[model samples]
Target: MAHVTFKENRITLIGNEVKTGNKAPDFTLLANDLSEVTLADTTGKVRIISVVPSIDTGVCDAQTRRFNEEAAKLENVDVLTVSADLPFAQSRWCAAAGLENIKTLSDHRDFSFAQNYGVGIEELRLLARSVFVLDSKDNVTYVEYVSEATNHPNYDAAIEAAKAAN
Candidate 1:
């Protein structure tokens, strides 16, 4: 298990830590339409998986919007924003934010992504702020587990990784 901070306090993360060069793990999560979506669903495309605690928060919102904008510029790439928010709430957030390119996925059904990716927060039951870039073949190329849950991720590095992966 790894550890992070929320507002400067320690928080333990539950699950296996993902590292670059590892084969990405597949997870079943709910799409905004309440449909089951898995990592295999987006095969043949470089993936940028943006994980956050909640979409309603400011940092999470900005992170998602940043990826949404970047996803439009990248070719042969798919950006998936995974959060613990419900499907309906995820849909509402995407709609309200006018995000069309990035897919909002809900891990509320099961914390499979959380535990598998090692981003789950044991204290709050939320995902730590992190971003992962996977190549078309499902190999992790880049990973950023934000040291602080409230801080932003390295968007430049993540985008560059996605570009390089493709």
Candidate 2:
């Protein structure tokens, strides 16, 4: 498990941490439209899964927006922001922020994505900050479990990994 801290205090992450070269775990999350979205649905494209506690927060907002912009330029890459926020809230935030390139998915219903990816923060019922890149064949090409929950991740490294996978 990844040792995680939120606001400087330690928190327990629910699942085993995934690493590069591992088979990416499959999960069912809710899309903005409330439809079930599975990893299998994204089979043929390189995926960048951005995990955050909540989309309404400063760091999460900025992170999603940054990926949205990057997604516009990455060929054959799908950037998906996963959070514990409700699907309605996720949709609202994306609309208000004018973010279209990156698809925001909600793990609020079952915490499946959070638990499977080992990013769920048990103390807060939110996801720990992390980033994952998966190639077309669903192998994890890169993984970043950000040490601090409130801090930003290594955006450049994640992007580079996605580009390489694509």
Candidate 1's displacement at residue 133, Å, is 0.4
Q: Model 2, 91-164: lDDT tens per residue?
A: 99988999889888999999998878998888888999999999999999999999999999999999999999
Candidate 1 lDDT over residue span 46-154, tens digit each? 9999998999999999999999999999999999999999989989988888999999999988999998999988888899999999999999999999998999999
Whole-structure CA lDDT of model 1: 0.93
lDDT of 2 at 23: 97
Estimate TM-scores for all models: 0.98, 0.98
Clashing residue pairs in candidate 2 (N, C-alpha, C atoms within 3 angstroms):
none
RMSD of 2: 0.7
